[model samples]
Target: MVVVKYLLKFLAVLLLFIEIDCDENDIESRVVDGQLVPIRRFPHVAFLRIVLPYGEENVCGGSIVNQFLLVTAAHCMDFVNLRRDSIWAYVGHENIDEINIIRSVKKKYIHEDYDPFLNTPISDIALLLLKEALPLHKTIQRILINIQFPSSKFVTEGYLAGWGLVDEVNETPTMWLRSITQELLDPRFCYRILNGRIPGTFCGGSKHANRPRPAMGDSGSGLISKHRELLGVMSVKSAKSPSVAFYTNVTSFYSWLVKTAQEALQSTCGHL
Candidate 1:
């Protein structure tokens, strides 16, 4: 009887994997337009599409930084097995043209504390170091990380961009840029939503149903303001209520970011 039970359980797990594979395969490919039409407005921004060794496609967003580093979410790392050939990180080009490839990742560093199970949002950030410096003069550059602590007393409005869905809930993701203004929700509110757990997480966005919000495949994308300062990384959404979404507060991770960037710079320019 135990042997039969184990067999049945194995089959169930296999079936679940199959379902998820199909769901990911169904992601719609829509050309980016609308708010994204003003490419000049966000010259430093870019998107990342992670392709698994098996050729499964999982889309996440990223930003260009300097000539070699790309910043995005750590959860995106879960999509591919580490043993697989190093995953590809396409930068600069949004359209499907092969000629626009910027540079490939020579190395990737995921936050050490990242938990695959909880998919912890607090540590849900990653950095990709390109093998070659991006052609900064000819190609656009990445927006610098927002280090200035915008006082919590002042509720600042921020913006996020991704190749995510267009509706309240969508299976197809638009290629055109979609953005919505979100007010920084207090950490207290975020803790309340999480039932007082993981206070490290911060919340944002309006409760208004009509307002556009981030959806699946939007993780690891850039959230910035008019100043072009990198703000937060789109992290979690209130599953019970999509109205409340959480982002990994970039300001909270400023020290780590600076340290990481400095180390990367030294290693890349070791000869200098």
Candidate 2:
């Protein structure tokens, strides 16, 4: 079996604009060092269709952790409220255009300390409670969240996946899933480069020749270590040109995550 040790517990995709303090306008995120992969490779990863008054758009990415839990970045939920009937989760497909399983979102539990504009954005994490548990099988499997500190090796080398477009402004979205390998850079180094605006996150990106950073639509994508363990969720691409990006570290907020999810399920999920 292909043991993919990626990061995170339950990941859910959010379809909100990941605005950055860049000179250019309309910037989101896409795969940088990317290669197309089969939809079945990462069966646990999920595609999201966000329906708002504007319209329906397949704009975010996530992973399946257990039966009814979905994890993702807090920024994804920044613009949208925790209304139960608005969000839907898709599985058993890589491309958003094809047929797949769709489920409704029950409730969203955002971290109490999530700050989108803080000096470093503390506790940039959120959880989604699903109406139904994920169906696990050969085509769909649940991955354990990275609740423990990763080894030095896994942190330095990891894989990230997304369906964001190459050109955020002009290009169309990709029809299939894409995966890339990147190095995990120190958050302190990234802070110095970002001038202290980045926080509660880790830095990672590929060494592509022409930058080729992640596209704009992959705001809630997952970043997993080489061992197939989830390390973080895509948060921001600190650089203006989009070479490297920031992700909300999963381990740092592991304790709060479990407690929030459990409490949410008992007292909150009944409403949905």
Candidate 3:
């Protein structure tokens, strides 16, 4: 009788653990001060599923630059061991729970100059080569990368979409994609505000305070211009100022991106 009682206790504990795991999985969509994205509105937006070497999983956002290429922040690949880690990209869905087209990453290229230890992250950009080309459809399309550098005198606004944390306090990601309009601050002001931590080769947060800004997990998403051009890759948020987010200017690395993409496509061997 004691053996049977112990067995029941063990099974009950196992059931409780399973229930907790399921509840955690149900938590979703955490973009701060963002709204639900319309279905197929940002088709180029790709959700990356990254499994680290230690078996922990995380997510980052990317933009489908082409049928075979994805653009994201280089920091997302930091500390990842490709031999033991895995990455997958999901496209064509606003809700993560919905079925979407998925592709494995065959190659990853981080900028040669990217240094994670720097006080300010420059060249914080990376590209992933999909194992198979994504089929272009109404729900799956590529966004053009903007190579034109913005003038330092003017403030420009763009849209930022992601499935990052809703707020610092809540610390949870949303199940659905969310987005907000962010004003790219003037270069001179941005430099002063961020105290030279970020350079002009990057997009800084709005001059107005308390604006909706990208948070954790939003890194690697695209900063898109009004013309549907990808202007930057989400990089970092200011530690002192939570509202001030930084993005890697895509225009600064246009040449490297083109060369790397061409090389990645031509090579038969995978470059992790």
Candidate 4:
């Protein structure tokens, strides 16, 4: 039977940034503040640090798109002042301390139909407007989010990484980067796990005893394929049966994405 679980809680990602320490294989997950953590764990995924006046929060994960815009989940804006200059996005930096490259949010646009309190996180995607365009050569690159049904072949047994929690709700945040592998169950099996709370969402988790699991703070992180293509965004999971996590299917929202991107590129809504 397929199992559905939320990846991590929203608060975890919204809290202070932490760094992890470990040897090559014997890595330890520690939550520390005021240190720079590298983003070498997931080459396919890019790490995004959302900065506010108080401090920087790894509140959301984003995909590189043309170096100027970072695509992320819209729910990342919850409790966040979208218009505040306190918001900043950093890309091409694995270590937060080094200050590899940073960009101010030119603007932010959330979907119109996005209801803050809906099941399945309706239209939960968001985009970060960067002050400067990115250079495609050394430090940055873009990944495509398919706007159609994803291949069960490419998606099954996929890899994902993010800065989330090491435990359940309100737990101490993970000090460093974390990641895991999971199986992409068929839609029918996934629906069974959600108890019919299916939001046209996709499913993936470790099929083996050693597969990686999403913790509390990994919300809005990307579930990526072997080719590094984005498949979904981590949104919800069962706090108890952690093995079952639910993510927004990127392919399912293709139509809306195309429209949104076009609108954002065209008018005064450059950052929306």
Error of 3 at 172 (Å): 1.6
| Stretches of candidate 1 exceeding 4 Å from the true structure | 1-34, 79-86, 93-99, 137-139, 152-155, 167-170, 197-200
* TM-scores, each model vs. reference: 0.77, 0.79, 0.82, 0.72
Q: What is the lDDT of residue 61 in candidate 2?
A: 72
lDDT for model 4? 0.56
The sequence of per-residue lDDT tens digits that candidate 2 reaches over residues 140-190 is 656456556587753676677777786555776776788877677766667
RMSD of 2: 10.5
Sorted by lDDT, highest first, which candidate order results? 3, 2, 1, 4
lDDT of 3 by residue, 141-198 (tens): 7787644664535437778888887876868678788998877765666576567745
Task: Write the residue-wise lDDT of candidate 1 on 1-272 in tens digits.
Answer: 99898668646533321221212232001112225544445555566666666667777777765666777788877755545645555544434243266566666777777787884475887777767665553335567565454666554877776666655434766656566667777667677778765633567776654455777767777777767777777777786556567777666766666667667656766632
- List candidate 3 stretches off by more than 4 Å: 1-30, 150-155, 197-200, 207-209, 268-272
Q: Where is model 2 more than 4 Å wrong at Cα?
A: 1-28, 56-58, 82-85, 117-120, 197-199, 206-209, 267-272
Better of 1 and 3 by TM-score: 3
Residue-pair clashes per prediction, in order, are: 7, 20, 10, 25
RMSD of 4: 12.1
Better of 1 and 4 by TM-score: 1
* Between candidates 3 and 4, the TM-score winner: 3
- Each prediction's Cα lDDT score? 0.62, 0.65, 0.75, 0.56
Cα error, candidate 4, residue 2 (Å):
34
Supply the TM-score for candidate 4.
0.72
All-Cα superposition RMSD per candidate: 16.0, 10.5, 18.4, 12.1
